[model samples]
Target chain A: MSTPSSEQEVHEHGVTEAVISYPQFLWKALGVATDGNALFYVWMTALTAVWLVGINAFAHQIVQGQGLTAMTDHVSWGMYIGNFTFAVGLAAGAVMMVIPAYLYHDEDMHDVVIVGEILAIAAVAVALAFVNVDIGRIDRLWHIIPFIGRFNFPVSMLTWDIIVLPGYFLINLHVVGYLLYMRFLGRKPNPKWYIPVVLLSIVWAVSIHTVTAFLYSGLGGRPFWNSAILAPRFVVSAFVSGPAFIVLALQIVRRFSDFYVGHKPIVTLINILRITAVVNLFLVGAEVFTEFYTGGSHVAAAEYLYFGLHGKNALVPWIWTAVVCNVVAAGIFLTVDPRKNLWIIDVACVMTLFGLWVEKGLGLIVPGFVPSTLHEVVEYLPNALEWKISLGIWALGLIIFTLGLKIAVAVFTGTMHVDAAHDAGEV
Target chain B: MSDPSRRTMLKGAGATLGAAAFARAVAPITEWTNDLSVEGFLQKHYKELTVEDMSAVLARIERETEEQYGAKVSVEDVRPTPGVQFAYALNLSVCIGCRRCAKACHEENNHDRATNNSYIRVLEMTNGSLNLEHGTVTYDHAVPAPGKFYMPVQCHQCDNAPCVRVCPVEATWKESDGIVVVDYDWCIGCRYCEAACPYHARRFNWSKPEIPADEINPDQAYLSNRIRPQGVMEKCTFCLHRTRRGKLPACLEACPTGARVFGNLADPDSEIRWVLENKRVFVLKEDLGTQPRFFYFFDE
Candidate 1:
């Protein structure tokens, strides 16, 4: 559990900030992404390949129309919408690190919070891409803009989503973008530029997921989503999955590059994950009990989700798997000291991420359509086309995250740091 | 002149290959442009378009429909008249599960042939049960098989319609005459309205809807049914094309048992108003307060 000390110790021992030249910093960082070992090239090429495949599939979809996918009249939304929901949660979950770092002034989380912010930007971008692809008419997207096309603001939750998601993306981009640019220039970041935005982003973070939850919850027809507890459940699960993702991502950053992510931040993150996972589990139980105990028309979706309805049990096994994974992951964190054994932390993090992905994605969306309003049980499963498109979107997000992380790591490690005293100052 | 280095040759080759690949990728778009004109692409939003613009858009749609489906169809822009509120009533006791009304609507509205995307779904329920949870929409048996009753459902055109409220682009809305319509061209095909409707009334055009030239409904309205393009949401407009023009809805006219009734609810002497006044009329999911203009009554 002892902190791994090396470059961090030296920096702390003497506050001798490495002076960097802005132009040289850019050149070095650019070179780092381009001039890499074979493995890095392979990784980048693989993602690009997948991304290109996805682009091909999406182009085919646009030409052929959405009919190529399994989405039917019964199930209007398929994999694309489900992935959008999960990505929004990932974006909102960035607030978990932000709240601790900025509000409580947790020094351990201060440096790591920017990593989460970058993640938020990537997640939001992917979520928006999903919307653009999923929609029947991308050409008509301008209709959602105010004054140009009649933007149904305030009333429509989807419009709220259109506003908040991009708004959040901009906020995170500004905060992370400014902080990194300042770091690259070897200058101190002014709090005035980012402080107010950081606070505003915290609220925007919670609102994005809450508004998304309302997109479902506000539906008068779908009883499965029309619950008072839905919003809170979304927020809680988001906190668990978002931080768990960052915890694993930080480990990758530490391993792959010279980024010095201390053990203290990981420990703090595990503590946060443990608490949120437990609360999320409790909320799941609460929803299950309320649905099963009441035994009303609304319970039709729950019955289909947990047990089979009309001999169709498509989601039954999936929901059960989610329940087991989340409960066991939370249990592991509670009992085992992940700080002592890093394996437990890694395993727990993967389990919670997978568990929440299923719980929120398919487990939330598909069942709402099952036992349709007229009470018809037509199960939905995403076809191959949807998977290809989804994989492409994910690959695109990862590519962005990888490149951003590369530049960020170079800046943080002072590999781009120059003898500013001799160079042509901060460009 | 020296031969190009390997790196230089690869760069040139890559650029050439990229251009070829880009051409291949854009081929479909070029073909689509042939069918969908640049004028169609630049068509203004339904609310923004002038009378001249709307007429031009309608002409383009008619021409395109003729070109694609090979049917000379009339696509008219039907406007709601003031002081005329539309309403519908279904007699649960008399409705046979024949689904003839649904079939007639399919043809009248020009629904897709492959999926038979009808807005109306007739649910057969066991007697003594009003619980929708137990209703079976896919009952393949004969009409009103012994112990079951039929209830055909469609857009209720609620005064405070959730579907209209949830449309992010205002693509769908309730008209002054109480008929909720979707501007097929304006809709982005997001399906938020589909998710919002409790009745599961809204249907999305998942792909380009196919219909034979002979089977295509020549009488089409812009707001009601004009063979919606791929990737937009459509629902029952209470047959606005017909009803707003002082004609009975196709479903009502096609119903054999006189179970379906359509009238201007704004008229005090209308059959729908009479049903509401005399019969024990009720709406589905009344507790949600959608206040649907469509009513159901047991023919006592």
Candidate 2:
């Protein structure tokens, strides 16, 4: 909570002026949530309301059993797992920004990269929450802990996922917490503080999405997800959607907060989207070609995805829509200059976000089960209750993100000034 | 900052309502706890349990089943004898798609009556092709229809069990006797095993399995067919309760055409070994390298 006279004066202070102490910083961070702004209060209340509704539904599902979901013997997993997959990609995508900021020393991206990190924190939390809800017994969750319950390590891809997800979460949490705390205390963060940790985070980011892909690819029974290209496809598409989300988030932050986000980071993010979208599309095309051109026993799953398999074509329209959105968004991003025409960039970002949502979220998971083992075709669609429960988890993530971002802005812009009494160590 | 008194009163009211709502949300958990015994809740993992602990757990399960299902069931932890590796052989040439095997499995394993859940899915394929894609499992016509062949698929009980490898918790495993079994109490019901099976052989309890007290299979095993909880996975255990006790599986006994064969593969003179050595026999999806003990063959 230390302000210079002007934006130029802020630079003159060299990001190390001692205008706030450690205790004051904690107080200010906590106080950010208590703002009297009607809009802030309304948004928080709405999120809490949605979360409560979701909890109620979850309780019902737990009591009555997963029969409330649309899943059957043919399709064991549904929207909960689909959303969990999407959230993992989102959490991993923060590394795309972190790499350029730290490794390449992109001066423009250095300050604003924390926004992506904050998003990753929220996304990871939501992903874990979805898994918790997806499991049949919440009371028995202690089984996954080492020693307490026998963990199937080294062999189970799910055990690998369980290890890596929270590992990545803790790395991001520690790195972000250290950097923000240092900044609030008006101290230059030691390179030792985040250097090795950030490097680990960069590799950890790639591992998270790759491990998620391996969860499907390693399953030999599900021919649709058994492709070798799935890992690359996951990473490329994560790069597309993850940056696209941050671009939209940056715009939102610009609208609401006084913290300055330069146009340069937005342009950089767009360039990333353009290249990765094309790569994502290329990988997808390769998958389709191999599936259709080979025309082997494995083609059944691909056929069911694109066309109807024995008159069960619930996902055909959804897959086609995803294809159109991805192709058009990639086309626009490749051709248009986001620097001059911001509106076009906005359109591309929205398309990329929604397109990836459909493609990776539902499109990727549902087809693997349609032509289920024994070659029966049974379509799966998320019922209304599943949607409500999913929205509730999403709302909870947004609340964490909104509150975190608010504190970040308050600290960064020096809006919450430190009092002299607090400097004097008074209670 | 202004009107602190009113703000404090609002906060108090919000706290009270939140507590009330939380209590309502947790009401079902109270019912869940009441349904489960304290002994069952505190039971250790199956492999870690001592013989006395297992007996206590089995007794607790028996009492609970009597209270819940109103059936006096005997739950035993049947162990596999040495040098006895169980195997199954199905004669495709004789199988008439009668689905008696499926029905027998539904009754023997205490499957959900509402869904008529069965581990065995008897798929009827076109006579000229072995492609499982054209197989129909819901055929309501007579047995052995013209231009059709029946293939019954169940837990292959593979040596390289993908289901066992994929479970996050080691709730399911391949026994020394070659049967893959699940600990219903230990399983978190993630259903990864259901997704892992190449045969679609696993069944999940979407709701509390409703089996009429009279219809309930009273002869139950700790590791095999028992009244499964609502959120666990269950599959065919080769009717281990009967098979380990030197009796044929109910499905094999129930088959009118004698299409099913069960024996110990370790015995050279077993009927399954004879079928394997002399008949055109193969396992389903053999290229996946699961090494299933269950084989299908056709008679000349």
Candidate 3:
């Protein structure tokens, strides 16, 4: 809030100076979509309406209290913290864009990268919203403020998180603002602005998830998450899952629209996915070796998550399925076939994204929280209401993302008007 | 960097006022008391407060708890009798599988009756292996069912505390008087100290603690036994609220077998000193270099 007056995208990023404001431009773009042919727009609109209805149904339930949900004593965190952790990992994905564009100096990606930063902001906001809704004591969020109703800072990691996350959100906001300004103005962004910001972002990204990881690992009794490898594992999961998601999203965009008119741009994004996915696979492989190799109490945790420890974790097959899919996604991308077919690239993206989503979103949490601290097995099943709420929120994200992109696309690719049929002649 | 959180600053202020008012109120009574060492001094932020500050902080402990916990609770100073050092020695040999000490600790600390959380755990250990390594302290099942010898576990009130070392924010620390206490509000709940503690003595409240109004301990200490928040870490404070005021811990009083003994290690003539002088007293995990105040012995 202390930051200076907002400058409109100051460069090719948005340099109309007296130019079209984003909210105005966004509405105008949405107006065109109501008239134009981006079917993603139609799905976006439909999902938004469905989300609203679901929220009404669940709001009544959540308002009456968490007593509304099926959360018994056993599954205390349940889908609430589940979705929160998932979104946090996705938000950390902003680094995928920030790291490549600024740190590694990949100038070609400069066009699409800030989208990731913007996505992170939305992810964090959504993560907070979900956590708020889950806690039911949504109004007490201000309690974290020191001197306000007793914010016990020294005693809580969640308290430390209250500080780190908002700070991360501010840093990401500033960096994206400058980058968008440079794009709008058609001027070089101050390297002074982006370079330091990127390094800070790199550490910050790792912290978001490491702190998230610490939230679980700090619980000395939860053997499933007690491994020292947890923080690094969280980082690997994020980079992989984040990029995999980008691929899925881009493919969805290309299928119904003309954005990727050529194979090269899409290919480049795929290669980025492949390299990251393969690196992710390698790390996961190392995780397996280290966990199973130790061969003791930790073995139960691994078995519980993957192969079924003492017949408790029914989610093991799902986790293993995720592992296999990720490994296969790496293989297909590495092969010559997917490289040759845009269709296959799209398919691999869909598949790998699903795998990573399942692994990070579902895999990270349920395993650790299972068999409450007292070693009693508590079942964690997402009821229809839980699914509906998550679906609604996810729809909310797609709607927000769609409108954001609708505005971003119009702003970034201003008036090219090259046969609005979009790639009628190209591959 | 000089700016502490407003919460910390105000708490610091509250603590200051409480101390000054206390010294004036009890100046005459405290005048010739040699136990008036820095142990009775003003408390420090685990980081900034020095030994002298601790001495200043302790002088003010005449239970203004009515202002804090909103109840009229008695505060008394309990010390070991002359020259007898107080150390807790549990007779694992005679420790029946009963969890009376755990129950006593819960009632003593004014824990929520429904939650029934306790600071002490009577671990049911299998004999002859001498390895508590595989023993579980979390069993809620009825005790002494089969081949099990019960061994109670609680805060060791360690002389060499790991929990105090890794705390980056200085929320938890060892008191000069051989007790460990946490500045509940200041604790960041990073739980680094929780993980650092090998004994798993620490616990975190994931939601607001709900103790029935009638059941709540009217006498509360801000850093000692007050109900903690949804996220901050908490653990056994050795009943510092009682110990500082010359009182025995509720667990010591409740151990039906007289297994638990509390006294000043500084007092050589205390019952705990006699236990040490006459019995084979041993501590848990001395190999890890944690000098635990809680000891175990077998009375033949």
- Computed on C-alphas against the true complex, the DockQ of each candidate is 0.61, 0.67, 0.04
C-alpha positional error of residue A158 in candidate 1 after TM-score superposition, expressed in Å: 0.9
The full ranking of all candidates by lDDT, starting with the best, is 2, 1, 3
TM-scores for all candidates: the values are 0.93, 0.94, 0.69
> Residue B202 in candidate 1 has what lDDT?
90
Question: Cα lDDT of all candidates, in order?
Answer: 0.86, 0.87, 0.62
Model 1: per-residue Cα lDDT over B1-300, one tens digit each: 234475457546755765676466546665545556678666777888899998998998998899888999999998999999888999998999899899988999999998877888998889989998768887887687998899999889999899999999888887889888888888998988888888988998888999999999899999887988888898999898998888988888889999988898788998888998999899999998999989999977
Which whole-number lDDT from 0 to 100 does residue A266 have in model 3? 45
Q: Per-residue lDDT for A163 in model 2?
A: 90
- The TM-score that candidate 2 achieves is 0.94
Question: How many pairs of residues collide in model 3?
Answer: 59
Worst 10 residues of 2 chain A by lDDT: A418-427
By lDDT, the best candidate is 2
Quickly count the clashes in candidate 1.
Answer: 1
Worst 10 residues of 3 chain B by lDDT: B34-43
Better of 2 and 3 by TM-score: 2
Those runs of model 1 whose alpha carbons end farther than 4 Å from true positions after fitting are A1-31, A417-427, B1-33
